[model samples]
Target: MTRSVALFATCLGDQLWPEVVEATVAVLERAGCRVTFDPAQTCCAQPAFNSGYHDEAKAVARAFVEVFERADAVVAPSGSCTAMVHRYPELFRDEPDWRARAEAVAHKAFELSAFLVRELGVVDLGARLSARVAWHDACHALRELGVHDEPRRLLRAVAGLELVELRTGESCCGFGGTFAVKFPELSTAMLDHKLSGLDDRVDVLSAVDSSCLMQMRGRLQRQGSRVRAMHLAEILASR
Candidate 1:
């Protein structure tokens, strides 16, 4: 039986990097899953939730649950958004109605790499990309979802791809949703620490979340760093 999956082409990936959305579909199709793009999807409402606006967050969460319930599973190319769906339930636990729905959705949401390895049984896409690359372990995906190894496993499977060790492998890019805007100086200081660790030997720095990449790229460009920001789906879709 062909498993059907819903694509959460998140707000960031949808607006900033449409190619990542396309690449995600390509990767899923290559793995033999029937992918459906739910145009009705919007921000996972993480910004609202993180800002302590549960009511506003629930409005979008309700729409998401309705749209994704039909699919056998929901797959997102973004680690942060997937993590939100998976982890946001705790925030709603005080409210019984939202808590149950949040639990049901969290159980179904899967990050791209996890979905590929666990649900689709795809070890690799037989993809080839020649570039020295490093990965950023976004806070939610790494700590919350325990997704540290899955992305690396898939990256290693790509022919000619080299995964380098970032000096502070577990450091945050400092994008923390509204955190960047609220404390720009502190955020940049943290980002500077993370970027200074890069050797510039890598041609691309890839992460599961675009928000992380965007912040990193801004600082890297300011310092004239040679590395370019890329998303994992973009790397996997590489020929």
Candidate 2:
């Protein structure tokens, strides 16, 4: 049986890193899943939700629920956004019907790595990327979603890929959506601490969240470091 999966392209993944979405599609298709993309999809309203705009967040969450209610599974390349989708029920708590729909949608959604490993029982994708890469755990994916070992397991299965330990791999990249913008100095300080922990040995830094990759990549670029930041989907899609 071919599982039907919907691609929930987060705002960041759709705008800043379409390659991540493309890679996600590639990985899903390679896993024997039928993938669908909806043009009507927009932001998961994580920004509004995080910034204390509950009504606006609820509106967007309702749209998301309507858009992806039918897929057997909804997979996103971003962990933070997936985590946000899981909060739709909270956004629509006062309304029983909408809350039920939101809860159902949340139950169907999964981060790409989690869907592949947990749902499809797939560990190896025959991906080949020869580089000393360190995997950074996106905070929401690690703590909120409990997606610690799945990504590493998939990475380890990639042929010729060397998964190195980043000293600050578990630390936040300081890209808490609005949190970074509201407190720039603190965010930068946290980012600097993260960067300082990186040794001179890694060639690529990979994470499940594009937002984190963007935060760390900007700093690495400013410092002119050779380490490249990439999404795990892109890495896993490599053949």
Candidate 3:
């Protein structure tokens, strides 16, 4: 049976790394999913939620649940945004009615890697790519979703893909949505520490969140480093 999945392209995803969103659609189709995208869907409201704007965040998150509440399964290439969806129920604590809706939608929501490996029992995508790759934990994906091994399992199955372990693979890239904006200096410092582990052994740095990739990629480009930052979906969709 083909699972009909609603693709939740996070706000940053559609704007910054549109190619990654395209890659996600291609990958899900290969995994036997009938993918649907609702352009009416908007932000997950993570930035506002994280920045202590509960009322504004709730408004946006309410719209989000309204769009995806009917989905059989909603998958996003972003761990950060998916993590925010998991917290939607809490965002509507006082409203029992909306909270119930949020809970149902959150339960069906999944990060890309976890959906493929754990839910779908798919580890390999028959992808071919020759390059040394490192997986970044993308904070929310690791701590919130407990998605540590799923991405690695899928990447290891890719032919000619050398999955290397970075010394600080699990560290934050300092791109915590608005967290990077509020403290630019501290953010750059944390990002520098995160990228200090990169070397010639790894050509591509892949993570489940595009926000983290954008943060690191900007620093790498400014420093004239050839290290490429890619979303996990892009690598998985490769052939």
Candidate 4:
């Protein structure tokens, strides 16, 4: 049976990182999975939820549940957004109707890396990118989602890739949605620590969420660092 998968490319990825979405589809197809893009998919409402707009978040969440209700699985390029979809149902625990919808959506969503490794079971996907690399663990992906190793597993499986450990591998880059705007000093301080860990040892930095990579790239560019930031999907699509 062909495993049908829905690609839930988040807003940033849809708007900016089309390559990531393309790579995500490429990897899944190469693994013999039938992937479809749900063009109606929107922001997973993480920004609204994190900003305390629960009602607006629920509207978006409900839309997603209704849209992808019949697909075999919903896969996303972002751990943060996927976690939001997976966990957003609990936000409406008091409302039985909305709560049920949230639970349905969450149960089907999967991070691209996690799905690639665990569900597809295809390692050594013929990816080839020769660069020293480090991974950033977004707050939602690390703490909320508990998805720490899948990306590394897939990265290591890439034929010509070298995955290096960041000095503080699990530290948050402080781009907690609005955290950077709310507390710029603390945000940069945290990112500075993350950037300092590079130490001429890596050529590229990758993460599941493009937001984190963009944030890191902004800081690295300001400091004139040559390290390139890429999404996990883009890296995996390498040949």
Candidate 5:
């Protein structure tokens, strides 16, 4: 059976890390899903929502709901964005009709790892990657979405991959969307603390969210660190 999945190309994934988008499609297709992309899709308004702009966030959230409503399932490469989508009903609390629609969209939306492991019942995609990798738990994915073990389960099943534990794997990488911008020094301080936990033995650092990777990768590059940061989708799609 072929499940129709609407690939919600997250703002960062589409603009900054398109490879993650492609990798997500490849992995979903490998799982017997027919993936579709809609240009009508845009940001899930997480930035505005996080910045305390409910009206603006609601507008973007409505657009997202309308765009992905018809798909059998909507999956995003970003756990943060997926978490934002799941909160659509709260955003539309004043409008009952929109709230109902938002609830439906929320029920259908899922992060990539969760959809693969929980919905499809697939832990392994026969991916091969010869590297010592450490998985970072994106705050929204772990705390908001409760997706701590699914990604680890999937990574453990990958052939030629050695999954190592990061001392600060469960801590925030300090990329709290606008939080970094609002508090630069505090964000940098938090990120530096997280980086210290990256063991020198790690060839690659993997996380379910590209936003976290982007933040960590920038700091790694600035400091001339050799460890590379990659999204879990890219690692899982590796063949």
Candidate 6:
């Protein structure tokens, strides 16, 4: 049976980097899943939720559940946003009916790498990127989704791609949504700490979440580092 998966292009994926969304679809299709997208999608409301606005976050999450509950499975390029979906049930924990719906929908959500590797049981999509790449673990993807090896496994399968450990691979990139805006100095300090670990051998620093890439990319560009920050989907979608 062909898997029908919906792509949740979170706000960043939609406006900031549509290419990541496109790349995600390309990779999913190559892995034999029929992908669908709903234009009704919007922010997963992580910002409001993280800031402790449950009522506001609940309002947004209700719409998100409405849009995606019917999908047989949901896949997104971002582990952070996918992690937000995992919170819907908790966001509505007081209401059993909404919680039930949220639980059902959240159960279907999957991060791209995890879905590609664990759900589909397929690897080696014939992706070829001749570069020394190191994977950066997006905070929510690592601590929330437990997605440590799936991305590495997929990257290792790519032809001519060398997967290396990013010394600060597990540390937060400090792009906690609005966290950076409110604490610019602290965010930069954390970003500096994360970047300090990237050595000269790496050609690209890959990560599942574009937000983290954007955080690192800004710093990398400002400092004139040659190591390109790329979304893992973009790297995997390469031929």
lDDT of 2: 0.91
Predicted candidate 1 versus true structure: per-residue lDDT over 29-143, tens digit per residue:
9888898987888888899988888889878877887777667788888788998888657877787887787788889999898889877778789889999998888888888
Native-to-model Cα distance after best TM-score fit, residue 95 in candidate 3, in Å? 0.6
Candidate 6 lands at a TM-score of 0.98
Instruction: Judging by TM-score, tell me the better candidate of 1 and 5.
Output: 5
lDDT per residue for candidate 5 within 106-217, as digits (tens), equals: 9999999999999999998999999999888999999989998899999999999999888976889999999898998999999999989988899999998999998999
For residues 99-138, what per-residue lDDT tens digits would candidate 3 score against the true structure?
A: 9999999999999999999889999999989999987889
lDDT of 2 at 63: 91
Candidate scoring better on lDDT of 4 and 6: 6
Which portions of model 3 miss their true places by more than 4 Å?
none
lDDT of each structure? 0.86, 0.91, 0.92, 0.85, 0.92, 0.93
- lDDT (Cα, 0-100) at 110 in candidate 4: 89
Clashing pairs in 5: none
- Report the C-alpha lDDT of model 2 over 88-196, residue by residue, as the tens digit: 8888889999999999999999999999999999999989999889889899999989999999999999998999878876888888988888999999999998877
Estimate, for each residue in 1-239, the C-alpha lDDT of model 6 and write its tens digit: 67999999889999999999999999999999999999999989889999999999999999999999999998999999999999888889899999999999999999999999999998889999999998899989989999999999999999999999978758888889898999999999999999888888999999999999999999999999999999999999999
lDDT of 5 at 229: 94
lDDT of 2 at 203: 89
lDDT of 1: 0.86
RMSD of model 4 against the true structure? 1.3
Ten contiguous residues minimizing lDDT sum, candidate 6: 166-175
| Tens digit per residue, CA lDDT, model 4, 1-239 | 57899888888899988888898999888878898887888788889898998889888878878777778899988888988887766877888987887787788888887887777777768899998888888777777777788888889988768898888778888788888899999999999988877768789999988889888998989988889999988888899
Q: Which is better, 3 or 4, measured by lDDT?
A: 3
> Could you tell me how far off, in angstroms, the CA of residue 105 lies in candidate 5 after the best superposition?
0.3
Sort by lDDT, best first.
Answer: 6, 3, 5, 2, 1, 4
TM-scores, each model vs. reference: 0.95, 0.98, 0.98, 0.96, 0.98, 0.98
**Model 1 regions more than 4 Å off:** none
Candidate 5 is scored at a TM of: 0.98
Q: Is candidate 1 or candidate 2 better by lDDT?
A: 2
